[model samples]
Target chain A: MKKLKRSARLVEMTQYLLSRPHTLIPLTTFADRYGAAKSSISEDLVIIKEVFEDEGMGELQTHAGAAGGVKFIPKMPKDQALIFAEELCRQLQQKDRVLPGGYLYMSDLLGQPSLMNEAGKIFATAFADQEIDVVMTVETKGIPLAYATGAQLNLPVVLVRRDHQVTEGSAVSINYVSGSHKSIHTMSLSRRALKEKSKVLIVDDFMKAGGTIQGMVDLLAEFDAEVAGVGVLVESGEVESEERLLRDYVSLATLAGVDSKSKEINVKPGNYFSK
Target chain B: MKKLKRSARLVEMTQYLLSRPHTLIPLTTFADRYGAAKSSISEDLVIIKEVFEDEGMGELQTHAGAAGGVKFIPKMPKDQALIFAEELCRQLQQKDRVLPGGYLYMSDLLGQPSLMNEAGKIFATAFADQEIDVVMTVETKGIPLAYATGAQLNLPVVLVRRDHQVTEGSAVSINYVSGSHKSIHTMSLSRRALKEKSKVLIVDDFMKAGGTIQGMVDLLAEFDAEVAGVGVLVESGEVESEERLLRDYVSLATLAGVDSKSKEINVKPGNYFSK
Candidate 1:
């Protein structure tokens, strides 16, 4: 590579660092790539770091040593996150979101990549300081949000399947009662998917009585993995505190109510703002 | 909010443009954000565009006139894409990945965010000029790949559920034969999930006889939608040409053979390289 002007070097370096979140890149890398001095690279990073902090994009941490480098920890500021969550609440409050059985249609919101990316950033921000080894989620609806969070945290996602499949090979299955329907359902995870003693962060699209998440917890026990944290996009406010299966978790929005008769729905920002 | 140095502006602008792919951003928007003249913004864009092109990051498209703006189109050059595909072939050829029924365990590979991001860029590049409205895939394994592709294309993703869920109100259900199992399975998509006449790009993790992809195509016909394109990570070479259901598609790698007894797996680059 040839030498580049400071402006071009800054642009390229920013792009490189943004794509690789949570990974350390030695100063020599930029210095060599742009055919510039290490001191010049350090100066460029100082400028990028200030803009990132001023814009609430994330924090760039620097390590000083032979193996030291800079790592970008992606984060969304509380004010910006609140604004996004409030917007989600507005979108969820639409009357048309109400289905026949008091269910809310959220597939459209989950389908939007930009929206998921933001929501993922919020979850990543919530659990940024934890020592998480992997991001876990069930099949289908929760997969996108899980992947979004995983991308930001630079973690692998292990999916628990609803039903056992031949492709998954040997698996450990568990039965947990579904809180909404009061019916027992089975969920399984492949033995090879998660390692023992792994710290897993669980994320989902929605939670009602926390039955599905509880099932995941039980399944994780079989693998000897620890539940590092739990994050959901929405949680039902109708469930009594006593009836809720989990005591500790995070949610971006809370579904207050859904009236099947009048086709009315209520939604608000979750406990994420209360912190 | 305030005017920034040229170097800082270049860094911030690069980050902003990279995040919002496929969306038009007017020169005035940048000018106002940085409190800079439109001419300075244009000059900054020229620098960013040159770096982007030199690094094979993507293309910065400029639209001229009153309603015009700049749009970022993400692309992965063929040489880099082939390198990634070959790396995938090596990973897939691991003997331990062979399962009881000769099915390779790919959930681990699909669990990787960085790997999926690159594959998504390759697919996005392949169909960059196509008139795509949404990226569609089946439940479970294909969800992440679909979302990855959707993120790069700046399109929403629609998932086809294997079993009808109450949450998906008034879905259109269709049964198709599973080519590998020779058994019939039903898949459904919510009526509200997709709009009529949508041009959809289908993606999946693997293809064997193209039964699942065929099912998605058949289901799309119910909505009067057109299949703009189809992409799979790995295609099964064991399936004879006569046994395959679909003709036009793209794949990153091909599974040549999987021996259950010897636990030997053969994987090669897909037709993507031949083009």
Candidate 2:
């Protein structure tokens, strides 16, 4: 009960050609169950079709007859990091989004779009195979869950704003000290909105004292880019995590605080729809 | 070539099998080219598979083969209501999203998500067919294009909040005047979000002076529910659309005022993508 190799059948055939729509699949049966060759599974289906057509979900087509293959059509899949952690754990398990001693009045799930499209489809299905291209957030409310994780990974959602206006021409800006540090917010970005070593992902909706995720990890290392992962919707299990850019995440609901006569709140459980 | 009768080829084959996804088709070639009766083309493919799974893109797989034939798989395709009105008129014809007079700064494209996932796949392809259920909006930025049009119409995204405290036991307040006169907001829902008559759609990202889209059309008429169309992203062509209550929108760009020279701004085109 364990025969799955060839880069794990090309990541389960690129997540079953990305969960259905125009389903197709050939390349000599993924080059006969990855025994390889069909030009090395067409160079791993051209790096999973250039990261799902540079992130806009569904379109891989590619056919050449005799029952050609490789289809994957149903668009909009990177799904803003699981619809922004399923609306940040359904707005931190609402009971009026708590706050006051338990904290959670997340400005109506960071100003709603159906709980950020199911928290950007569970944070774009937990980075459906990674490599991301862009999708970073940091501003007054992690720009709608980093534009729903650049619209479920079809990538291209920049913004860091807080000032430095004049139409984002040349800027990087930082500052930090938000969340309980007292004041100071800054941030800026748009020195061509990213592209050096590229890769990025970093999203946000809420996180406590981690100072706006270390002011967007020092503005993605001042644009050398390459963070790759850092999803967050609601996290603060006693703070601390930036744990070497936490690979994959989805706090969804996690407060574990408040009780002075039942401000209670407990929530937690969002490693991308664990159930 | 006007030879296309038979209820206009079954309404363009039920809109090309409702712009595809979970394909399926048959009922004797739509009852042998409308000569009728395969149980009246299986009750017109069960009212086009209950209006494309009540307008969420798709699913109608009924294969009781003798080598059956009812494959549609195209869900959400009213050509995405003209690709969400050409992506809300290319994000309201950017030039640095105007503002300050012609006001189109769209809170940074309503805190983007791949342009709210092509404005929620052009309003989930114009309510895919209609049965919706929920996906309303109203809050700081029509909650990321109403949760990317309720995650491609898979539905369930009710918000409406403005001010309804007491941990929300009862609510439905209204009152308008967005950029001037009368105000007051409150909405609150949670009696398990929605159901009575269901249907809904609402959506927003920016409309200005429709007065929060007419206070979310009077909080979906205090929950008798069933509005089904008022989508938006940007409207305010000096808002006075001869009385409001959205008639389905798409706007990616619009704003024709304050251009006496607030540095130049007029912008036009609002039905960006259409259904």
Candidate 3:
């Protein structure tokens, strides 16, 4: 409420923009709040913009005219994303993470907030240009990543439950064959969770044969929602071409091969780098 | 990184501190990064600290002497928290949210990233003084809230699953009786998820008879962990005194009552305000 000097105002403005990403705030709003001239506010934004780019924090897009102002878009530089993916690959290559039946034990990595936040930033950057109304993920493991990306994109997250809970009210349920096992499984989404004809971005922690993703895509059709994009933390590189259920998606890492007997695991940076 | 001016350095410093909450960053690090004297970095922090408080963003705690620097503690002011709780109550009071057996449909609210971020800040402030090593919550609904709090606290989150999955490897499971149902239920946590004797903060989306919270508490004991604090977004006000399982906890809102016949619901701010 009180008029602050430029130094104090810059600190406050930076934090405000960081907190509320993807939302436009008019210059008048900041000008009135700080009791500063429009030109002064514009100058302050230019300084913030330069630092943001140099630090790899993100972008501050400015718009002109009465109805336009500025919007913060969270993004991770390609080199920084590669560094993160490489670190993740190293973590995944640990022999002990290989569970029975070739399942990689990554719950620990997923549980770490810093790691999840970095992963979220990458996903947010990958889908930064898409018109996504919501980020959707299946229940349990993927919830955190979905929430993290949603937070970055300033979008609501919609969760699909494996078993419909009574607490969610009326729900639409569908059965799809699992990619690996070829067994039928049901996934449900609350009717109220998503609006009709929304452009939805699908995200997941891991993908094998892309069956679960396909299931989600099929489920989205029930709501009359369009698939804007799909992103995954890891994908099974060993899946046969005929077995793969989905094709278009971005992955941070690929599980190339798992030698259970030899306790050898191979993890490579996903298609993200190649793209 | 190249040397930046005071204005540019201030912007970078604020964003750095905000991104890495609870972690200590020495002044020398900033001084070295910007090729500035420690005194300059200290002065910049002063401006950041003042603006952080004035804007009700959070606290920037500075420690003096060698091996000391500043730490950012994310917090939501009391008035802002109350406003958030009131808004949550209004949303929860919608008649259609009441399901059979008095269950409330809150998945939509929980799915929203902005709301969850606000709730996380409130919980982080409530237990800001506690020495918490990790944030814990049971499977499914509580995962998002737990992750959000963990992100704010800059701590790892451990999820206790209802059913142990093979992907989690070896797990430590315990059976606890439901406080209201008087029935036994199994809650499992991965043996690798938590360190022994860790100080943990428990969070959940909703609490009824406190059975689930109690279950988590009992489960924590299996890992030789200590319960630093417990936080819930909403607690059932209708639970009888004799049925209450836990009394020492914080709640953002209270579901006072629900009239299924008239489709009317009663809601109030939780005990967070009373304290």
| Top-DockQ structure, candidate number | 1
Clashes of 3: 0
What lDDT does each candidate get?
0.94, 0.59, 0.92
- The residue-level lDDT of candidate 2 at A184 comes to 84
Model 1: per-residue lDDT, tens digit, B201-241?
A: 99999999999999999999999999999999999999978
Candidate 3 local lDDT, residue B25 = 94
Give per-model TM-scores: 0.99, 0.29, 0.98
Give candidate 1 regions above 4 Å deviation.
Answer: none
Runs in model 2 lying further than 4 Å from the true structure: A1-41, A49-68, A71-267, A270-275, B1-116, B120-144, B149-159, B162-275
Give the per-residue lDDT digits (tens) of candidate 2, residues B159-185.
Answer: 665656443334556655554345554
What ranges in model 3 sit over 4 Å off? none
lDDT digits (tens) for residues B83-106 of candidate 3: 999999999999988887777888
Residue clash pairs of candidate 1: none
Write one digit per residue (lDDT tens) for candidate 2, span A1-275: 23443434444455345434244678887676556667766766666665555444445778878888776543444344445445445546556555444544555445445466456556665665677777777644566677765655556676677677553455788887775555787878867567777887878865655667777777888877777777777666655554323434555555556453454555565544453
Ranking by DockQ: 1, 3, 2
Better of 2 and 3 by lDDT: 3
Lowest lDDT sum, 10 consecutive residues, model 1 chain B, at: B1-10
Model 1: what is its DockQ?
0.89
DockQ of all predictions against the true structure, Cα-based: 0.89, 0.07, 0.88
